[model samples]
Each structure stands twice: as C-alpha cells, then as structure tokens.
Target: MASTIRVRATSSGETTEVQVLIQHPMDSGFVKDAKGETIPPHFIRELTFEYDGKNVFIADWGAAVSKDPYVKFSFKGGKKGDDLKISWIDNKGETDTTTAKIQ
Candidate 1:
C-alpha cells in the first residue's frame, strides 16, 4: 500500500495556512531484535510544496522525525481555488505526491 496524504488550507485576508498529514512508517535503523540484528533506517528526507507551479516551500528531515509524520506550514500569495501540490521522497528512494486547492 502507498502512503496516505492529506492537505488542508485556510485563507485569512491575504495569507494561506496549509497543514499536511502524511502516513508513513519512518523506520529508524537503531533497534535490535531478539536475534540482535540491526534494523535499517528508512525515513522521509525531503518534501517540496508548490502553489500553482511556483515553489512555495521545502523541508529536509531526518530519522528523528516521527512515523506518520504531520507538518503544518503557511504561505502568502495563495488565493481561493489555487492548487497546492506537494511531493516527498524517502530515504529508501520512494516517492509520493498529493494536492489540495485553496479555499
């Protein structure tokens, strides 16, 4: 199954606040099993957000991030009906994308 992503945006005056929820198993390679085997670290490393084809935000994360990570961010210049596209890449080379429209 693929990761689940949700986006929400609220506009007040001339600014838009966006919140994103991404469901993923951010595995950190620091745990050992009963057999004493090392676990591999796998997590989302980068996220990019664009508003109507213009770069709006970018985030770089590490293993310290939690599983099923959720991020809340806001930007200006977005208006009602504008499209917000978000894309992310994990340490394991997996990629996912989602979109939301300003309202």
Candidate 2:
C-alpha cells in the first residue's frame, strides 16, 4: 500500500528543516453530511519525528486540526544522507510511518 505520509528533510550544516503532509479525514464530529448526520471524530492523536535515535519534534493533536494537516519544523544536528523517521497514530488506532533522508 502507498504511504499516507509525505515528508521532506533538508540539512543546512547546523540544522535540519522538516516538512510533513498527511492524508486524513480529520472529522471533528460536529459537521454534518448531506443527510444531516454528524460526522464522527477522526484525527491524528500523535505525531513524532526522530533522527539518529532521538526525537526532535512531536505533536499532540485533536479533532480541531484541519484535514490533511501540514507541519514544518527545524531541529539542530542533522547530517546529509541521514535518516529522519516520521510516524503518526490516529484516534482509530490506524498508523503510518516513513523514513526520509536528509538532503
């Protein structure tokens, strides 16, 4: 299956900039469909980024987050060609993970 995560990491000698985009419904349980039924809450509960076995960034999200969320952050001490691991778990227990190389 295709990964639902898309990420990019770039190193600038001293820091690495990371950007991520995730595909998700992110229903807040307040909106209604055409039939006027409330949408159930479904959102990413946690997101994490790791480099060199150390976590550099983490996000605790809720249903208030918009769909297909985009995040950007920078961290110190990443080298070119090194790996950055990204993962997320949703409220439904669904998960996806991917690794991106610092460029």
Candidate 3:
C-alpha cells in the first residue's frame, strides 16, 4: 500500500503548533473478497513525531481505525526553522518517515 504524509507548523512568538495529515488504507482482515477469500489485516501499528531530535508524540493504532487517517496535534518547545520528523510502521513490517522544518 502507498502512503502520504503532510506536515504544517505555525509559530506564535515563543510557541509553535503542528498539524499532520496521513493517508493510508487501514485494512482489516474481517472483510472477504469477491471470491469469499479472507483479506489479510493490514494497518499502521505505530506512529511517532519528533522535534529537533526530541520525541514529542507517539501513537499505537489498531485495525478499528478508518482508512486514510489524519491526525492533528500540537506541542511546546518548537521554534521557527526547527526540524520536525514523523515516522510510522505498518503491520506488514514496512516503515516510512518524513521531515519538515518549521517556517
């Protein structure tokens, strides 16, 4: 499966807020194919966010989540031009990561 992640951050004086959008097909094995074959469970298992090498947020997800999930959150200790990193791992043992800097 293909995934896409977008990150945006805003600064207000000494504080910063970040927003993230993630796209993925959170498939559950309960569904059956046209031929009545059981589909394998495939979903994101973990997600992590960091700012300037400091861990900020982490989440553990399950198959109950919907496809193309989008999450928005904010934290302190962020400044303009600081690097923000986001990463995720899927049940299939695949991993993906992306980084963006506050502007």
Candidate 4:
C-alpha cells in the first residue's frame, strides 16, 4: 500500500528544508457524522523526522489540527542523496512511515 506520509527534503549546502503532508481525518469528537453520531477523536499524536540516525524535527498534534496537515521546517545539516525518515502515529494507534531522499 502507498504511504500516507509525503515528504520533500532539499539541501542547500548548510541547511536542509523539509516539507511534509499527512493524510488523515483528524476528527475532534465534537463533530457529528451523517448519522448524527460523534466522530470520536482521531488525530495524529506525534510526527517525527530523522536524518543521519538523529531526530531533526518532531511535532505533537491534537484534534485542533485540520485534516491532512502540512508542515515545513529547516534543519542545520543534511546532504543531497541522504535519506530522511518520516513517521507519525495517530490517536487510534495507527501509524505510517516513509523515507525521502534529499534533493
């Protein structure tokens, strides 16, 4: 199956810029479904990005975050052709991970 995480990492000699997009429902439990039942809380609890065996970025999120969240940040050191690992875990214990090559 295809990963729910999409990431792009670009290195510019001294820094690496990272962008991520995650596909999720992010239900806050306050909204009702078509049947008027609560949707329940379902959102990403944490997101991690690793490079060279170390974490470069981490995000702690909650239901206040919108569906299909997008994030962008820059790190101190990275090189082209290296791999960046991205992963996330939702409130329901579901997880998805992906590796992106620096460009």
- TM-scores for candidates 1 onward, in order: 0.88, 0.97, 0.86, 0.97
- In the range 1-103, model 4's lDDT, one tens digit per residue, is 8899888899999999999988999899899989999989999999999999999999999899999999999999899999999999999999999999999
Write down the lDDT that model 4 would get: 0.94
Model 3 per-residue lDDT tens digits across residues 29-59 = 8999999998899999998998877888898
What local lDDT score does residue 48 receive in model 2, on the 0 to 100 scale? 98
Q: Score each candidate by Cα lDDT.
A: 0.86, 0.94, 0.83, 0.94
Compare the candidates by TM-score and give the number of the best one. 2
- Name every residue pair that clashes in candidate 2: none
User: Alpha carbon lDDT of residue 80, candidate 4?
Assistant: 98
The residue-by-residue lDDT of candidate 2 on 63-84, one tens digit each, is 9899999999999889999999
| Model 4 lDDT-worst window of ten | 1-10
Query: For all candidates, what are the clash counts?
Result: 1, 0, 0, 0
- The positional error of residue 67 in candidate 2, measured at the CA in angstroms, is 0.5
Candidate 2 wrong stretches, greater than 4 Å? none
Worst 10 residues of 3 by lDDT: 1-10
Cα deviation at 68, candidate 2, in Å, is: 0.3
* Model 3 misplaced stretches (Cα beyond 4 Å): 1-3
Question: In terms of TM-score, how similar is model 3 to the real structure?
Answer: 0.86
**Model 4, position 32: C-alpha lDDT score:** 94
